[model samples]
Target: MRSEPVPAPAGDRRSRATAELTWPGKRVGHHAGLVPVPSPARASWDVRGRLVCGERADSLLLRADAGVALAELLAAPGAVDGGVKLCYLDPPYNTGERFAHYDDRSDRAAWLSTLRDHLLLARELLAADGSLWLHLDDSEQHRARCVLDEVFGEEAFVATIIWQKRTSRDNRKAFSSMHDYIHVYAPAGPKVWKSVRNGLPDEGAFSNPDGDPRGPWRSVPMNVQAGHATAGQFYTVTTPTGVRHDPPPGRCWTYTAPRLAELVADGRVYWPRGGDGKPRLKRYQSEVTGLAPFTIWTADEVGDTGSAKRALLSEFPGLQAFDTPKPLGLLERIVSVATDPGDLVLDYYLGSGTTAVAAQRLGRRWIGVEQSARTVEEFTLPRLHAAWADAPGGGFAFGAF
Candidate 1:
């Protein structure tokens, strides 16, 4: 493999001039830094420190520098253009805190430059409608957003989602921080990205009180603001029970007169007062895809950091839990939203292999790259083996470079 800074490809629109976040060693438009050579041999692991040879594995874990592994993947002959659907990164926060697994300290400019290198490679790995989810806290999210905007255009930004990572408050600090930020960016426009994104399954919003043959359904108001209404939308509606209702002030019927009549004939209209009140439109459960995701994610919906630690403890007893391991539910939500079955997921900062496990459980192909050999052997491999054994179908190959 080559050991040189790889410049952005010719004719890439990402090189266009825009406001950039300045750093001492910033390479500007170039993807700076050399990737380490990945080891040639690939081995399989059924559990921690146990090797299983000659099995077909669909996923991979490369114990090498993130940037290096990414470069190798790009250079592979089997690499597909626009192949990876999602890149979920949970890199070192550079918070200046020493942990058992990593040294979380680095110069600001150096860290940003390193992150820029990874982002550039990740960008190259993305599909046409792909997305990048960057997870960070207050440590460097502001500066990270600048780098993201510079690399993936400000117009590509989707949303800044807030995830409640903890429910308990720390009395030692002035104000306990309980949330983490997940910034989403898509090179494709937001609309195109969202069109491909999956929504959370609807929960407890549908019911059938009338025992309709169609099935459980939910009702919505049949009126909308009259500002853009046509003449037909302002017509009075007479219900089947002989009660006449006029379009409310500044509001008109959502449907035209003919459409409303057709709906009423088909028994798709719900009356609030036992079949003699304001009519509502019936939305059948079979017609619903799912509930649209919102900006805020509560710990109740997705497990908190504490729960993640407990899960790790239970999964691999006697092993030291990662200080900042992401909850499985959090990654599941992200994977579900960003990819479909068989789509490829890339996580350069694989850490404890949470991204790989999430992708595998959700039926997506994945590649995880981590630098720490100890962490890979102790935490990543064991956890992945457990996940693989529980969800037995696909296999993964592991290698140290």
Candidate 2:
């Protein structure tokens, strides 16, 4: 067993109580103003409840302080040395609202200063090829972007993804706000980043009607857009059906004459039997690249606020409602795009643990940090435990600073 001192009280000048906490086979000692500790630790309980002492801890970690946990992660040798693949954060929006545990009200200077500190630490934690996804509302997105540009540099800016967070309009307000912005940044430019592709949806359009030996295929237009045509793209062609055609009024052939002839010889061009339709290119399913991720994410593509609330209610019955919990589908989409299986993901705010849950479902390692003991005990930890029980492969360790 190891013993350690509890943290000193914050902003209290009076003489304070102090106690030692023992771990690895003992109960934690009670101290004034200390957060409530869990019951006697067991084999299944990997909750550290204090700073981790030794190596060989689980990849899934739940820490009680963002600053302490981030500092520890950066200081740990080889733990996060150019290793973290993605850092996704959904910090408090500073909307001047009161939550169950913390107040969202902060002066502009204090809020920006706090965010700047966190962003600086987070930038250090990112690998050369790593990316950061910061979620925020319109209230402070511009300011946040300025801070990010300062920390990560203007050249590191990637994209601002707009997520449609709601479907129904609010009747009380003059303008119903229904979207949230997710700012993405990379330590390095596009060369070090990987492109994210969405799975191809099954459609009846793909069919090998002619039984081509290659595979099922679909016909796509063989003309470039009106304003995007190059000089070499303007051409005339005669199809196999003996029909002569020229590039459309403004549009041009998608391929040059030589390329078109080569494709025709290779049986990759499709000419209609009627000899009247325009030539088309046969896009084989085997050669198709998946759909690239786009900036606008509709509610159907990811999920809405209602779905998120229902998911939380279903996951943990009798739990108090969180004011703004992100949908699992939304986080799942972000994780799927930003990382691969076994990559490290960090969520500092960890409001309802949606990020951790999404990472777990996708078979990625994750770390979550939250300051509220009530949240960790009642919502985050239990939700993660339930997710693990449902899947039963990966486990997590809990710690405090």
Number of the predicted model whose lDDT against the real structure is largest: 1
Model 1: per-residue Cα lDDT over 170-260, one tens digit each: 9998989999999998877576676678878877578899898999999989999999998889887877687999978999999998998
In the order shown, the candidates' Cα RMSDs to the true structure are 6.1, 12.5
Overall lDDT per candidate, in order of appearance? 0.81, 0.72
In candidate 1, the residue pairs with backbone N, CA or C atoms under 3 Å apart (3 or more residues apart, or in different chains) clash, namely: none
User: Which residue pairs show backbone clashes in model 2?
Assistant: 48-398
- Give the alpha carbon lDDT tens digit for every residue of 1-401 in model 2: 00232132122221112322122322222122222233333223334333232233344555456765666566555655446778899988888889875678877766776676677677777756567999999778888887777667666677899999999999998899999999988766443453431333335368998899999999988998768767888877887677789988878999988898899899898887665677899998887755556789999989988889888888777877776889998999888777767777889899789998888888877788888887777788778877666644546666765
Worst 10 residues of 2 by lDDT: 8-17
Clashes of each: 0, 1
Q: Best candidate per TM-score, number?
A: 1
